[model samples]
Target: MIPFRFLHAADLHLDSRFAGLSQLPQAIRSYLRESTFAALGRLVGVAIEEKVDFVVISGDVYDVSDASLQGQLRFYEALKELGAHGIHVYLIHGNHDPLDGPRLQMELPEHVTVFGAGEPGQAVACRRSDSREVAVISGISYPTAKVTENTALLFNRKPGSTLFHIALLHGNVDGDLQHETYSPCSRKDLIGRGFDYWALGHIHKRSILHENPVIVYPGNIQGRSVKETGPKGCYVVEVNEEGYAQLRFRELDSVRWQVREIPIEGLADEAEWTRAVEQAVEDIREELPQLMSVVRFRLTGRGNVHRILSEKGAAADLLTELQRRETVRAERSEYAGLVWTEGFSVETGLSIDRERLLQEDSFLGEMLRLSRHSGQSAEGLDDLLSAALKPLMENRELRRLLAGAGEEEKLGWLTSAAELGITLLSGVEDEGGAAGPMFSNGAAAARHEREAEE
Candidate 1:
């Protein structure tokens, strides 16, 4: 058996837009716009640096159903660059970029070999130094958008061939409920198949289902959404002369996405929280020092600052300050490797304990008791929320937004409403701007003054 090495990457998603994002600064937007292409470049850089024999890109060559011309040309350039280095590229089409999908008329470099859509295709990867065949690569592309059949069954390895075999597939395995079940196959079926390695794609999270024969998913090349966080890259596999493979993961994404949930329980006021937010960003910056990244913050836990942050525009104002803080860093750097704040949400509860509030023996107490009971039962919560939100549902925007609101989210809104009511009606804020328990201050009534004689 001859020794060889190759880079395994998948889900290029070139020219893909950042999901759930808009209204960005020109510099950040341009970086995001070219993020996938930049990631591809980095993958190629890693491949060259590692001196791999070839690169196997397992499906999803483009983001769109029909390949975009810009993405196609950019991918072609990358292949051409690899060709210049005498490195081969074996790629296949996934549901997103199928073989039958409409694409521009352009020929890829000679070093690039594309597997066919009709049947499982085969290509031999030779050792770079001697040009001796060392590995057999088998793969297939989706003929159309929907490939529900078990396509993995089509693959058949050589009867007694001693060459290393790698299979590239893009589909959902059974019980992989996180992604849509496309070209479904069972783990038993894949493992039973005689292949030295199984490089998978379509699901954006990396996982190694088996190691004996090396079944793995390298995840997407770029983090196009906040949901797809952390380092996104490829696996470099080195097969020693004894026919065992050592795998290494290399992150090639230039732009990363992250979501952080920070608790603000001890933080007292806006000043403390502002410093806290800056520190959080700095910590993240140190962690992802090399890449441009976006972060969304979910501030949680009961605190006095929650009341201050609950005021209208406080969250937005904080976000503005955060952006301003990063803007200076952005101006200093070319790509703004510092963390940029995408969104800041206030999800904290009131400092006063709801259990104690429910025993107050007043209307507020009864309301809190009802809220607690409603949250315990799904049907009760839905009924209470629907009736309470009926008037507001008439507004198209609010109606559209809340239509998809789940039981927990609606319950959060309900809790926030009650907190607002108690905070305002009970006048919990002291003269020193401290928030005491709801109804802790002495009660006062509106004077019944005789209407001034007009």
Candidate 2:
């Protein structure tokens, strides 16, 4: 038998947040802020329950640049518990918790081993009484925040014949667009070193790059935002006597954040919209324990509802109302609690008068053409447009004007301009011409109406 069973975990972005949790209700805000520590405790609990030979935290134990002494002490206490059980704990500093800093003043337990920031080195862990000898455990810690050079060069040495070689690292493997390319390396760099398994971290999403050498990122122990969705947890690796390894993901997160998009194509009334929103929440609730998850509901699809839902006050109010509901509040809110928001847009049940509008030869049409072209090069045009159009879309007077405009008056102005945008975007003519009442079209019309109203 392999005689060694271990849990591999990384990227515990402890005490982190998703931009604006403070603005939510106190109950939810408090939960969101405290969930990180809760997840960390869960990790230690799993380690004890499994009775593994050792536990390896690849990197990023906490998120704070200057983590509190209390937080560090809490973590030390957890490790100490494992130490008491005669289970050794191994760790390395990731990008978030680089070696250089205002260090937390705490003495680690005897059974704990933290990799240093110097040249690549190995830590030998063994059980003499059982005649069990695990080969060289090699690892390197992040010395600074931005490590650009290849750090794999440090761990080029192979292990002796009598031991199982395991290497731990905290850096981007290759071109991971989601993360900065710190200490970049490749599968070849790791496998070439003749290591048995490469315990890696940095990316927050769990993935297995290579199985032969057992390269893995256990992801974050808990999710922190809508971006980090689905089942958040760690991995358990069991290495057999012949060096063959089997990996299984173990769920450890207390509160998971999920993003779900609900279509509104045929929702005819307020009841239907409410039901749809409820359904989205229910789906998430069904998939996860209500009391342990927060969901971000994104309203998608084409229809008049898009206009109503996209309005800043209406949208914000809807989210607030959803947050206040008992079913949502009690179950599906974030540890901080739940707050819904609109997501990506798809065309709704609205049409434009492309032919008649394109016939116009006016300054507005030329301006539209300019907007279309300039929008291409504009880096943050979407944000700028959204900000500029808020007042117009919300104004009752502006909506009435938009809803009642004639072909010659309204269609001619907007169609020509829309074509310019189409040309810039697709290098083609505006196939969907002068759309119906701006409010009925979708977010673009509502946005434009808001701008006009302003």
Candidate 3:
């Protein structure tokens, strides 16, 4: 006979908006929005497949207590499906979904039990067939968004009880700085507390805090940003007759986020750069074969590729080409398994002696020095730029034409002016820096607009 089984999941964070990405195509945006819901559906499927007795969701069921109606409706569908399979769900509210916060208060399925705040809530698990006792589950929810007290100490497990015990909690353990310190507690506070398993939440990265007693964090089911990278899913645990547990992590994210920094030190030209980017996509596809991936790419180091990117309109053209690789299936608007570039950045610098240029006693050198200072200290730069543009803004007719370039725009122009001059001057020195073009009306070049979006 199977000893005992259950699924441990937390930090669902449904309807959580993605960060660091803007102006995504409609189809891609839909994929990102639906990813959390898709993971919940998969979680339900896993419970039915594994034939687990129950599902324990520690906390943060919604991104907010007053979550969107769409998020609640979708979540309802998944739980309804699991209930149909005879699986019971035990849940608690986290900092994001506090008990006192606004909620829809919709009636949940009969098999779903949510623990309340203040005093820890208690429930017992039993076999549906014969009413045989399985385990005792105790948990507490957040009374409000800010829970400073150590709620973990308030649990009651009935000492010397014959049945196994499981503690469902959502809090910061040992004041983990990566997460907000709520319901604070220590490993000492949790251990030796008669819990056979500790189902925990609030920290979005999966961590096995301890074994034997089996304390763990399943992490979030979906990766909402580059910071939450790699495989994210719930843990399927099997407890033997003696109460020892084994864990298996499953990936359910519909879309994955990643950050890749490629060195462009020796890449020769635009063709090589394109090839490198393509390879990166292929590599990520290989790394995560089950889900679609969105990458934030940062091209680094100095190379000929940097010079081409410095040319006007070339970077945008490359981005357009990269986006062209994405394909939406004709039948559905959901994300197909195509690799999407969330954002692209070029940190590669010019291949000239910047230090010597700044130190030189020439007109270009002086300009470089002044521009450098203007870029370094944003405080006084705005005043100088605004003064210079005052003539244009003061003229009644010209103000109507040029007032759009505000203080921020002027600041950007001053910051990039030195690099633009260097690119122009270098172009006149030779054909692709070949040492003999000398004012030969060289090929037109334009500076790249931005270094990074974030």
Candidate 4:
């Protein structure tokens, strides 16, 4: 029934490279390179500031196979600093950094306790102030790259133990499809162990499956790719004298990856469209002021300027301008909003109303009907898209992008294609001449009118 506090963190993934990013700006790339280390430093800073009894890093401390010796040295220095503060650190190696790998052998400070790799291990730490046993932490490290055993089954409960019992584990629970099913175990299996807390890893999204026994996943300290978005951080947990506990999430990432969808339906012209884009960027910047984030925009909706927006160079040009805007701010101010637009896709259609077009007894009406019908029929759209994308499927790059695309994603791609086809056809004149550009004169005319009024 003693009160205690501890920091629970996992998936450090130190020295991991940012994946799926192509041609990022130099500044952003440098930040990505250092983000994992920066985040770990912040976690250590939080633990020291909170003055926690100990820190539990569940797994994936540093990959011995892929990570550099420099990363290993930094990892050790962090634990050494904690040891100097008289704080204990309990760590376990995950699949990415198993014990059997060609890792550096170094002596850690006496305050650091790493669980054994061959089997489930136990380590007890007494409170320095009172010289009484305050916590008993149990965990295991991966002995090989692939550990298929349900390791949670190895844990046993003490009938009337007084100290707080915690289990640190790194594996999938009930076959989590998001990750490799290593050291897999069921939630029921863990619940039966009767531990006071379960600190889990291998899933990069924080989750609390059961609060009764305080089972938690603090997620990775830093996101290493576009697939991993939003804020990434760890948790600080406090257990009161009565045995009840509280969990607090702490945000600790310097950069983030996000996707935003903005509709351009009601935008009158290029000026209005630019304003909308700026507004969205500002909103996201406000939401994540502390982190420098990159966003990929999905511009969707039928509009008068659909052709202008869908031009071959529109998306690239817009992205360049947005990036320039952020760079200007970065140069001018020491502390300003740090957001960059990575790239975008223009998925738009003609302003022609579909219901009205369908009423016409012509090719346009027939085409609209066919597109709608195919979208409604499950197999029709799938077959059409499969045939259209057959040639592209042979390309390794595109194949990677389409690997796990579901029905909805395929349908979305087809819908965008159909919309683009309609827009092109609608703009073609009967005389075989291209229609005049759709860029409106509204902005210039407005300026003229304002000058006249002035």
**TM-scores for the candidates:** 0.78, 0.74, 0.74, 0.78
Error of 2 at 318 (Å): 0.9
Candidates ranked by lDDT: 1, 4, 3, 2
Better of 3 and 4 by TM-score: 4
Off by over 4 Å in 4: 327-336, 352-454
Per residue, candidate 3 scores C-alpha lDDT tens digits across 201-253 of 99989999999677898999998876687788999998888778999998888
Candidate 2 on 1-454: residue-level lDDT in tens?
A: 3456788889876665544343565666666666677777877787778767788888888755647665677787778777777778788988888887556766787788889887766777664236376656788888877778888778855533656778889988866645677989987888888777899999888999998888888898877655677777878777778878889888877677666667777887556877887777666656664436656555554455644554433545566566667436545543333333322222232323444444457654555554545455434344434455567878885665544444344343444345434334332322245232222234532453333222
> Which pairs clash (backbone N, Cα, C closer than 3 Å) in model 3?
312-446
- Looking at model 4, residue 336 earns an lDDT score of 34
Candidate 4 lDDT tens digits, 1-454: 7888889999998887766444566656666677799998998899889888899999998766567887888899899888877789998889988888776789888898889776678888676567578888899999887999899998876556778889989999866554778999988999889898999998888899889888888989987755577889999999899888799999888878787887878888777888888899999889888777867676777775566665444556677888877777656542235887766655555576668777778887787777788788769877777777889999995775565466787777666655655556565432224543322223322343333222
- Top candidate by TM-score: 1
Better model by TM-score: candidate 2 vs candidate 4: 4
Error of 1 at 103 (Å): 1.7
| Clash-forming residue pairs, model 4 | none
- Per candidate, the number of residue pairs that clash is 0, 22, 1, 0
Model 3: number of backbone collisions: 1
Q: What is the C-alpha RMSD of each candidate to the true structure, in Å?
A: 10.4, 11.2, 11.1, 9.1
Error of 2 at 415 (Å): 20
Query: How high a TM-score does candidate 2 get?
Result: 0.74
